[model samples]
Target: METLAFIPSPSAGEIHLGPLPLRGYALCIILGVFVAVWLGGRRWVARGGQAGTVADIAVWAVPFGLVGGRLYHVITDYQLYFGEGRNPVDAVRIWDGGLGIWGAIALGALGAWIGCRRRGIALPAYADAVAPGIVLAQALGRWGNWFNQELYGRPTDLPWALKIDPEHRPVDTPDLATYHPTFLYESLWCVGVALLVIWADRRFRLGHGRAFALYVAGYTVGRFWIEYMRVDDAHHVLGMRLNNWTAIVVFLLAVVYIVVSAKKRPGREEIVEPEAEAEPEPGTDTGGPDSADADAAPEGSSAEGSSSAKEPSEDGPGRGKPSGGKPAGDGGGDGPAGAESVAKGPEPRRKAVDGPAS
Candidate 1:
């Protein structure tokens, strides 16, 4: 029972601030969310997206992910809440702990899709940008399990084993004081997954959701082995845990998607957000020849003015006029006719400029 080093479970998962209560589980989840958004925003901007786009999309994604995570936990472990003499209301108490990563990812993706569609962003590009951040968030989120003292693995006497309080210990292992800290294992695994995704993404330039798929595959690989060590109650299928099966299926799907996506889309997206393409650079001509003509109109007016000045002589009052005091051309004189000639002079020059521009 004696261990040289071990992680001790928190005595209490929540602390009261006067009348307010702060749960460590909730705090960890919140901190993870902030980290994800911050990192995702940076990566998104690095990929030519707007600064706030990731946070904006997360507004939709986070809520949906929380709800989906809760729903998955409640449904999968229905006996804990909906069974005989159980209070179904307890299912809504997510602060107590329990969230399914699979459900969170599935529904969170739907939310992200909605946000990306509204913002005119490609979902695959957004997924690729945020993939590493998402895995990092999962790394932080696993600490929530540590706070709750739940989801520990089989009992162990190893130096790094987690010490569980008697009250928190599973009924079947009443004498065992230490168990594998699956939370820590999963947390560390997620960090590794995040690093792997970042390195591979940079090296291979994964796009079209391939980076996201790589994260899924890497995460599920760890989850499958980690899930095997957990002693928590779970539904079993064909002698294997339901989650194990889920992990296998998800991993295979992720691998398949990575291969197919890489073949279909061979490079990283040149533009993550469509709005970037629409923004015109300063001093750049985005409007074509008509705009060029408008810009040149001022110069043409100045030229016309100079020509008009030269046309009239500085002799007597009627120097340029004929003996009968009439203008030479059909343009009446220096009145409306001269004004019209000056105005029309720019038209021919404008047309000449337009020819090459067109």
Candidate 2:
């Protein structure tokens, strides 16, 4: 049968620019990372997290995710990189394309955990904020597979089939020209997953990582079916591909987490970053050292006068009047101590407000 139309694979995966080679696969991955960080940062800020926190955390998560993805691909498909005829060094060439989403997410979460802990942020809240962006990143990253002309499915003459190069075609089907575009299928599915996550998160007000869990479950459901379509050589168990089994396990786990987490802690987190919480109202007594000092002052004595006497002049030899004209102990001045006092102003405390019960 003559093919009417189909997607054409790229003739070359890399381009040269002044002796520097830029791989399409690498470009896609890089673009995906930037997009993820941008979107995640917005979501995080909306959730009361500090702006740019997602990008800061991405510094740790991205590298760990890349390494984990490459390791997973090499380990699972050892025959492609190991043995007498294969080159072990090729395994490190990630730009050539090959990444396992499973390993990338697993290790990426570990990296995010480390980043979150350093920032004194909760991992679940961070995950919830970035869930949609992560899946969107996967959607963009799947284009890498399209550029490399790998991971196509069984031969088909469908209009949307992918035309594989003769050299890239499976040895057993050298005569076949077109095959199912599993990469496109997965990419489109990931996009849908991202949309679903965003909608569900808003509609249900998912929290405690439940938004991330929803994305995981939704992606796995698509992966289970998409993985079945692929003809690429992969380990099989009980007549099903290894990834199929993985999808099943991961889907179940995600669902369990969503249900249990909702029961334990329902609704979204009121405060994503403790440090970003609103400070006590101005002139409101915070019960800090300053407040304690004011309470202990004599009944007729002025608290400000007593504080000025106890606090040293930040500028010169005067206590109540400084060279800057600002009163002493008022947390204003160019001096180091005054600057320190201003910078370390009372730590903000979260106001308690009960969330609706699940």
Residue-wise C-alpha lDDT for candidate 1, range 284-355, written one tens digit per residue: 878887675565554445444333444345444543566675443223355776557546655534333223
lDDT of each: 0.86, 0.85
State the TM-score for model 2. 0.80
Per-model TM-score on C-alpha atoms? 0.84, 0.80
User: Which residue runs does candidate 1 get wrong by more than 4 Å?
Assistant: 16-19, 282-291, 294-358
Candidate 2 root-mean-square deviation in Å: 13.0
* Candidate 1 TM-score versus the reference: 0.84
Model 2, residue 299: displacement in angstroms? Answer: 12
User: Which residue pairs come into collision in candidate 1?
Assistant: none
When summed lDDT is taken over every stretch of 10 residues in candidate 2, the lowest stretch is: 348-357
- Residue 99, candidate 2: Cα error in Å is 0.6
Best prediction by TM-score? 1
Check candidate 2 and list the clashing pairs: none
